[model samples]
Target chain A: MIGRLNHVAIAVPDLEAASAQYRDALGATVGGPQDEPDHGVTVVFIELPNTKIELLYPLGEASPIQGFLDKNPSGGIHHVCYEVEDILVARDHLIETGARVLGGGEPKIGAHGKPVLFLHPKDFNGCLIELEQV
Target chain B: MIGRLNHVAIAVPDLEAASAQYRDALGATVGGPQDEPDHGVTVVFIELPNTKIELLYPLGEASPIQGFLDKNPSGGIHHVCYEVEDILVARDHLIETGARVLGGGEPKIGAHGKPVLFLHPKDFNGCLIELEQV
Candidate 1:
């Protein structure tokens, strides 16, 4: 079963501005920025009492956020991360039901330091979903 | 303060089909369909262990889902709802800090029978946010 919502990610053109808005304007506790070179993006987490909001920005020319921001100039929600009891079990179940796991069908170390897998958006009716093992 | 992640709303072209996908395929407990005329959408709640997923379909000629579905024909995540400890406090803080509340800044009765308010998509970096009093 899906445990809980881990975080919701938004692709932003300017990470500092987005982080500042959530911190200064919303009065939310904001974490410092961190670069995930493997993912080709830099991110800052806004700490909400319920769940975290991840602000993603391109870290390099090959960053995927570059493409997402190119299409949505004003930035937008990119994806959501939900916690799962066991990622391998969830992965097998999703595959058994014809859900395609992205990134070569293996889990990766996500921003939360948990094993995470991405499911194909087409399989989930056009919404990209991330499952993280808790 | 936000209490917990309440639910995530997804716009769907076919409510029954989407509900079935989550139920039979994802092994989730699905609830019966509900007509929310005030919101102009019919929704089905998929019960996950920690949170719920709301599948929404247009209910009338002027339903907002019609436009969202028109843009994303295959359907997609529409908005996310988070529980707030106090609705009025959260609203006042958000407004005072420059967040635009939707529907004239009044809390409406949402699907979960709670007082809910929607924040503007532009304010929080293009994510339509719902704050529910819990």
Candidate 2:
């Protein structure tokens, strides 16, 4: 099952402006940006008291966020990540329950360097749920 | 500043079906449904170790979720809630930082029986954020 809410990801058309908003406006501690080639997103982490916010920008034209932005135009909440003790265990259980795991059902290295799997939105009531091994 | 992530709200087409998916499929501990008339939504809470998942369904046609469902049809993530120590202090700070507080800048009694206010998505990188006084 899901553990702590690891981070909530927001896809932004402009990452710098988004980061500035969190830093200057919200007075949040904004972390440096890192490119997640596997996920095709350049991400900035906003450190909060109990959780983190991920600002995602399309790394390339083929980035998944690019498509989301194309449809949404203004960018928006892209996904929510939940931590799990063991992602493989969670994946197996979710698969048995008929949840479609995105990306061939294999765990990929997420922003935190943890193995992560994404559950299909349709299976999770329209929200893309990310399960990351803690 | 936020204290902790209280819950992530997901707007669902059917509350029962969504609850079943978490309870039966995900093996999560699901709570009873509650009608939040003021919010115009019926909600079910999914308890987790570090946070909760709130499943929201339109209580009436006038429900704000009704508009989201009409566009998404299948349902999806609605908003992310973060707990704050003092809501009024946080609200003033956010306002000074140029964040638009939704609903005329007044905190309403939310589902948890706590004061909650929503910030506009445009001000927060297109992610609708809810701050609750814990």
Candidate 3:
């Protein structure tokens, strides 16, 4: 079961501008960009009191977020992550309830170095959901 | 300045089905639908430990989310609401930094009965941002 709202990932066409917007324009504590080669994206963390907003930009040609940026030229909210206590149990329960997990239904070590699985957007009201074990 | 991420609003085409998905499949604490005629949406609150996910559905004829649902029939992330200490001060600062506030630049009572303002998506990495005085 989902516990806490982990972070909301926004795929931005320009990572620097998005980071600046959150840091300067929005007055939030933002971290430096870190390239996540495994995830195929560059991420900047905007730390909030209760949660985080991750600014994501495509890292390489085969980046998964590249397609999302292509569809949303300016950028958009890519996915919402929820923290789960036990990922395997969560995945099994979700699977039993007819929810499709992406990446061959296996939990991969996520950008945060935690076991994470992505759920199909269609099964989640068109909102891409990432379940991270915490 | 942005403080806490108050909630993430997801506009869904089918309110009941979406609520069920969160309640049954995701196993989150879900609240019943409440229609906000002024906001032109019916919202169901999914209470997370740190924040909330607001499931929005078109309420009346002039529902703002109708256009969003039209574009994304399955539903999608509509906006992200950030809590502000002072709505007016936040508005003035954002304006000084060249961010355009929607709805004629005036803070209106949001669905939560707090003063709120929406920022233009074009200036916000294509993500609609709502600032609420909390």
Candidate 4:
């Protein structure tokens, strides 16, 4: 079973500005500002009591975040993450259900080095879902 | 400050069917299948470790869930809720920032008797946000 909610990812045009607004308005502390060269995006995390909020911004012209921003325009939720006991099990279950795995392999270290993997949004009716094991 | 994530609401075509899908797929036990006569929605709750998942289906032709489902053909997330220490404070803060309050006043006892209020989607970039205090 999925253990708990890990975080909710939000796609933003500018991570810094979004982070500042979230901090000032919600009083959430910023955790990290890290880059994912593989995905061509930069992400920052804000920790909350039961879950974290991740702000994502495209790092390059070819980044998926840019496409999402262009499509949504208003910068809303990008994905919802569920913490799992085993990433491989979750990935396999999703794969068995014909869901496309974004990373195409076992989970790798994510923002805080926790094992994480993302499933394609198409399979979930336009909602991106991520599985993480800490 | 937002204390935690209270729930994630999904607009579905059928509450019972969606509840079954979520229960069988994620092994989450169903909590409630209550009706909101005010909003014209029949909602089901599935409790998780730190948050709840709410499946909402329209009760009448004028229900907002119908409009949401009609707009987004493919079923997707409807709203993400944050638990607040004080619903009035949170509502006031959001209203001061020019966000329209859907309920137009202090929160009332929502499902399970918690104070809850929803913000107008137009203000939040098409995302329906709910503030709940439990």
Candidate 5:
């Protein structure tokens, strides 16, 4: 069962600029500015009362953010993460339903020290989704 | 300040099919099958622990869902709703910051008996967002 919304990940052309906009314009507080070299991207997290907002920008040319930006032309909502009680169980359930896991192995630590995994958009009718265990 | 995530609205070609899939595959319980004649769509709401998932299908040919489906093709996440303490204040803040409101008016009762308003995606860099006062 879905627990709660953990965060909404947005792909931005510039993380710093977007982070500033969210903070100054939306009355949100920034939680982080972290770099994930493995994913070829950098992120800034904004904490909300019940859920957080993560702004993501490509760190390199081959990052997925670049591709998403190319397709949408404008930065937009990238994914919605749902908090789960157990990452492994959620992962298995998703896989059992023929959903493709973006990463080929077990759930790993994602941005902000949370265990997470991604389900491909292809299986969910073009909605990229993240499952996290907090 | 934001209260919590109220729901994530998804544009879909067929609400019944999508709702069934979510219920059967995700083990979620359905909360509503509502119609918003003004918005030209019918929606099905699936309640989660802390947030809800809304599957929207156009009721008329000129409905916004059709446009979104055309733009994304395979169907995808359309918008995220954030719960707020006061809808009027949030609306004023967004407008003061030069963000456009999709429907120019006060918060109206939306799906699941909540007062809500929408922010145009054009101002948000391609992300339609809703604000609900719960």
Candidate 6:
């Protein structure tokens, strides 16, 4: 089952501008950008009191977010992550309930070095959901 | 300054189905729907440990989310709300930094009964941001 709301990922066309907007305009503590080759994105974490806002930018040629950026040129909220106690259990329960998991239904080590799986957006009211083991 | 991420609002085409999905598939504690006429949406809150996921549906004829739902028929993330110590101070600072506030630059009573203001999505990496005085 989902526990805590992990982070909301926003795919931005310009990572630096987005980071600056959060840090200066919003007056929030934002971390430096870190390239996530495995995830095919560069991420900057905006630390809030209760959760994080992840600014994502396409990293490589096959960056998954590139398509998202193509569709949303100015970028948009890409996904919302929820922390789960036991990911396998959560996946199985979700499967039994007819929810489809993405990427062949296998958990991959996420950007945070935690096991994570993405659920199909269609099954989740058009919201891409990432379940991270915590 | 932005303090806590109060909630992430997801505009859904079908409110009941979306609520059921969160309640049954995601195993989240979903609250009953409350029609916020002034905000022009009916909302169902999914209480997470640290924050909340608000499921929004069009309430009346002039529902703001109706346009969003029209563009994204399956529904999608509408906005992200962040708590602020003082909304007016935050507004003035944001304005000084060239960020545009929506709704004629005045704080309106949000669905949570708190003073809230929406920022222009164009200036916010294409994400609608809501600032709530908490």
**Residue range A1-134, candidate 5, lDDT tens digits:** 66777778888866676776677666778866788887778888877776777888888768878988888766999998887888888778877877788879488887657888888886676788888897
Q: For candidate 4, what's the RMSD?
A: 2.7
- Lowest lDDT block of 10, candidate 4 chain A: A119-128
Candidate 4 stretches with Cα past 4 Å from truth are A97-109, B103-109, B120-126
Where model 3 places Cα greater than 4 Å from the true spot, the runs are none
User: What is the C-alpha lDDT profile of model 4 across A1-134, one tens digit per residue?
Assistant: 67687888788766676676567655567866788877678998878888887888888679877877898776778888888887887777766655688866677787657888887765554567778886
Q: Provide the lowest-lDDT 10-residue window in model 3 chain B.
A: B12-21
The worst-scoring run of ten residues by lDDT in candidate 1 chain A lies at: A20-29
List iRMS (one decimal) for every candidate: 2.2, 1.8, 0.6, 2.5, 2.0, 0.7
Candidate 2, B1-134: lDDT as tens digits: 66667888999988898999888877778998999888899999998877788999999668988988999898988898888889999999989887899999999998778999999987776678899998
> What TM-score, over all chains together, does every model reach?
0.90, 0.92, 0.99, 0.85, 0.88, 0.99
DockQ leader:
3
Q: Is the docking of candidate 6 incorrect, acceptable, medium or high quality?
A: high
Q: What is the C-alpha local distance difference test score of each model? A: 0.84, 0.86, 0.94, 0.75, 0.78, 0.94
Model 5, stretches more than 4 Å misplaced? Answer: B105-109, B112-115
Error of 2 at A39 (Å): 2.6
What overall lDDT, based on C-alpha atoms, would model 4 receive against the true structure?
A: 0.75
Worst 10 residues of 3 chain A by lDDT: A14-23
Q: List model 6 lDDT by residue over A20-96, tens digit each.
A: 98999898999999999998999999999999999999999999999999998989999999999999999999999
How far out, in Å, is residue A74 in model 1? 1.8
In the range B1-134, model 4's lDDT, one tens digit per residue, is: 67777778777765665676556655567865888877778888877788877777778668877877888766678898878888888877776766688856778777557888887755554466777786
Global lDDT of model 1: 0.84
TM-score of 3: 0.99
Error of 6 at A54 (Å): 0.6
